[model samples]
Target: MLIIEGLTRRYGDRIAVDDVCLEVPRGSFVGVIGRSGAGKSTLLRMVNRLADPSAGRILWEGRDVTALQGRALRDWRARCAMVFQQFNLSGRLDVLTNVLVGRLNAVPAHRSLLRLWSAEDRAIALSALERFDIGELAAQRAEHLSGGQQQRVAIARALVQEPDIILADEPIASLDPRNTRVVMDALARINREFGITVLCNLHALDIARAYCDRLVGLSAGRLVFDGPPEALDAAAARELYGLEADEAVDHAPALPGPTPQVAPFALHA
Candidate 1:
């Protein structure tokens, strides 16, 4: 189980994530939903240790993730891989090489710097690509793939990490409706077939409801609701998004426009 206790992040006086607490069970698919500045992304970044919390603790199993540093922190990150909104792949690199980057922590620095991957490592990376139905694209440049395919390559790369948890931060925000469904379905498959814990930050309530086993609603950085998707009624939606019941329909897109300004550390993904 992953336990978050009184987790908080602040930018001088403003609290981006305030006193949030929750427990995530193993092999569960969780969706973290909110408006642009509601701290959904901040919370996930903290979990992955990409951003440090101003206060509180994140406990995975029995260890405090907030306190890890150096090699320990690197190992922790390897176990908890992140999938970003931008699909963070080396566009110039071939698909196979991009996927193989996930093994950086396990491979020796010298070998990785020289791009010398072992046959087993190459096979593993190829298998991950095949799992996502993109093995044929392994020889192509990552930049040449379509948005849906690039996102799938990103997922394949995450799978190569053999992570216990995958933190997807607004992964579908930039994709079209069709690609959105494809990416979301891939995440669902990973969670269900591989039993990897998934914590996805999403803007669409309909997608969250359809894909996540549990929903966590954040409003102005405070966790307002935690329950099964069926329990996120109109009233709960209103409380979470500050919207009228009619505007809180499952298909309603997140409020469009510039996201509210957050701390610089929290903006990178």
Candidate 2:
């Protein structure tokens, strides 16, 4: 289990994430929802130590992640992989090579810097690409692929990390509806089939409700709600978004219920 206790982050005098606490069970799919500056990204980054906490503790299993340093911290980060809003791929590199980068944690530093990957490593990278049905694009430059495909490549790269937990920070924020579905489906598949724990930060309530087993709502850097999607009624939506439920819906596009299908636009609300 992943335990967060009184987690807090502050910059100057402004608090970004305020005394937040949560428990994420093994193999569960969780969605963190909030407005753009509501500290969703800050909270997720703290999990992998991308952003350091000002106070409190983050414990995975029983070890305090906040206290780890050097090689220990490196190992912690590898075990807890992260996916970003902008697909963090090397545009000049081929898809396969980019995916192979995930193996850097396991390979010797000199070998990785030289781009010398073993045959077994190459095979593993190919398998990860195939998992996302992009094996044919292995030889193509990452920049040449479509946005959805690039995002899938990002996921494939994360898979090669062999992480126990995946923290996706607004991974679908930049995608069109169709691409969003594709990425979400891949994440769901990874969670269900591989039993990897996933904590995704999302903007759309519809997408969160459809895909996540549990929903966590944050507003102004403080958690406001935590429950199943079905429990997020109109009143809760209003509370979470700081707008009337109907107003929130009016600002957001109607999204299809959770399924392996695609639409055309993204819903920011």
Candidate 3:
């Protein structure tokens, strides 16, 4: 379980996250929803210590992560995996090699700097690639894959970390309808089969309501709501996002910017 208390983050005069407190239980699929600056990304980054919290305690499996450092910090971070919308893969490296990068906690950082991953690690990465439906692209450069395939590669890399919790920051920001279903279903399957906790940042209410077990709504850096998907009704979303009842009418998911595409998935319990 992940417990957060009094969490706060600030950048100069701007408060990014404000006194947030919440618990994310194991095997739960939770989605953080808000507009551009609602601090959804900041919260997930803070959870993995990629970004420091100005003040607060992040407890992972009963251990306080606020005070961890050096080997301890590394160990704690190893138990958590992060996925980004951009995939964050080495464009020049093969997909299998990119996945193996997750094992950096076990490998010497210096060796990683030299791009050396063990044969055993490569095999494990291949297995993950197969599971994510991109095993054929294992030897291909990351930049060579399509957007959907690239996200699959990213998921494979996260799986390589063997983490109990996965934090996905706008993971489906650039996928088509088919790929969105593929990726979200993969996450759901992992949660159901392996009991891994998934905390994701989603822009579409339809997507969150369709896949997530619970929804967390943030407004202006403060959490406005945290409950099951059913709790975030059309009216509640309008308040959280400053959208009119009609404006929230047809939210679509697509690459950020330009005309936002309507979400393809039908929302249901």
Candidate 4:
């Protein structure tokens, strides 16, 4: 379980997070949505310790994560995984090698940087690929794979790390419709099968309603709304989206892709 209390972050005189408090239980999926610069990514980064909160405490399981250092910090980090919007893979390396690098946190730094993975590491990497159903692309270089394939490889890498929760920062923002569904489906399956908690920042309400169990909305660095997707009606959407809603939806095409597996949902665990 993850517990955040009075979470806050500020840049000089500007406040990015304003005493927001939340709890994520084990094996739950939550989505965050808002216009640009909503501090959604900032909130996730704080949980992973990528960005420190100026004032607050993040409790993982039962320990105060903010107080951890050295080995403790490293171990805490290993349990939280991050997936980037730009698929941050080493394009020069083969897909298999890229996923194998996920084990780096547990390996010696020198060995990890040199890419001298052990035989056991190789097995772990292969197993992750199989889990994602992308083992066939093992030998292919990262740049050679399609966007969907690259994202899948990234997921496999995260899986190999044995993370408890996945923090995706606008993961599908750059993908085409087809690839978008592929990547989103992969995330959904991981959440269902492996019970990996998911905290995703998304731009589309439709996607949030489809895949996420809960929705947290931010506007101008403040928490404006938090509830189930179905509860966020057109009126509430207008408040969050502002006067641009009509123009935005008018331009949105029905993106072609596999319809996501909607299920009985609950607040973030």
Local distance difference test, per candidate?
Answer: 0.87, 0.87, 0.82, 0.81
Q: Higher lDDT: candidate 3 or 4?
A: 3
Please provide, for model 1 over 99-193, each residue's C-alpha lDDT reduced to its tens digit, 9 standing for 90 to 100: 99998988999999999999988888887787767889999999999888898999888888888899999999888877887788778877876
Candidate 1 weakest lDDT stretch, 10 residues: 260-269
Global CA lDDT of candidate 1, please?
0.87
For model 4, the stretches where C-alpha displacement exceeds 4 angstroms are: 246-269
**Model 3 lDDT tens row, 125-155:** 7877777667888889998889889888888
| lDDT, residue 18, model 2 | 97
lDDT of 3 at 250: 40
For residue 196, give model 4's deviation from the true position in Å.
1.1
Which lDDT value does model 2 have at 230? 91
Residue pairs in candidate 2 whose N, alpha carbon or C atoms collide under 3 angstroms: none
Q: What is the per-residue lDDT of model 4 for residues 43-136, given as tens digits with 9 covering 90 to 100?
A: 8888889899999899988899999888888877778888888889999999999998788887898998788899988877887776667788
Ranking by lDDT: 2, 1, 3, 4
> Residue 8 error for model 4, in Å?
1.0
Q: Cα miss at 238, model 1 (Å)?
A: 1.0
Alpha-carbon TM-score of each model against the true structure:
0.91, 0.92, 0.88, 0.88
